[model samples]
Target: MATVDRSTLAGRRDAAALLLGYACAARVSELVALDIADVRETPEGLLVTIYRRKIKTFTEVAVPYGRIPASCPVRAVRDLLAAMAEAGHTSGPLLVRITRHGHIAPPLTRGGKQIGDPHGRMTAEACAEIVGRIAAAAGLEGRWTGHSLRRGFATAARRAGATLERIGRHGGWKDGSTALLGYLEEGDRWTDNPVTGL
Candidate 1:
């Protein structure tokens, strides 16, 4: 079946993580380190705070509720939050350990003491694995990782004619970065060079 049973809490959270990762061009560590406190609604859109390891600083970015409902990060995140709230989760890690059976139950039953994720925060390895798994399922061949999302962002943005400076800032790269140099897709956007046209 092409249908997904998003009625399940685990399913909702997974979908949210996947969509948010792509929309934000997130690093795996950043995605797993996310907390309920890091997300908020601003006048512009849904704001996501990403803590960069290289700079050791937090940067907030916005993800629009795209026209496509199925792939919308904003809607996915909102749905996940609602599901978590219903389960008595007010705060803590946004990414959690999903059991083999797809349950998000706390690991400990004694006194209902639940540490964030109970099973513990989702590891970067797990995050990468999920990205690859989802890609394969979508019929995409070749290896994919958490970094793949960032690379995909750069390639797509470049192809769409977004400036390198804007792409660097969006990816949280240091100023005047060549970080995007290797991520460019094979193409010449200026073949119809605007300067020549002018």
Candidate 2:
């Protein structure tokens, strides 16, 4: 997140997307489907509404202020919103494609031809590609996909002493989910290992 340049709108957008996604433990699909109105500022922090495609329902994710100001999700989102508003994009998709020349991409249209996805919003693939690009730019050597944010959130929360129920609820994982347990176990692997000091 610190690697992202705050001076540029594109950079701010990327940072906000990544931070918010991680903070909310949201899937890429839910992250990209977000509209400006879906995220609201609260006294404590942010209230984000995520649409679960599989469940056909919406879930509210709470994102509180971070202890570290530099890595705060709330600050990142506020900065992005301010930048977008200055660019005359006060509404519509929270994340959209920015052209090489540094302008928002126009809405897609099918001029008498059939188009599968006609909306101008960013796709899940595009979001993943952005994640990869940012990771590479940061000189991180790993296969970083958009899903990495969610996984990181789970691990970080677990390592920070968050309970399984809280982690599952925040990440929208079902109770007693094996996948959730896997992430928690992985988070615990380095700390207080059975083989440590043996």
**Which candidate gets the maximum TM-score versus the true structure?**
2
lDDT of 1: 0.77
Question: Model 1 off-target regions past 4 Å?
Answer: 1-5, 107-119, 188-198
* Per-model CA lDDT versus the true structure: 0.77, 0.84
Which pairs clash in the backbone of model 2? Answer: none
Q: Candidate 2's error at 51, in angstroms?
A: 1.1
lDDT score for candidate 2 against the true structure: 0.84
Query: Per-residue alpha-carbon lDDT of model 2 for 65-116, expressed as tens digits?
Result: 9899878999999998998888898888998887777777765657867543
What TM-score, to 2 decimals, does candidate 1 have? 0.83
RMSD of each: 4.0, 2.7
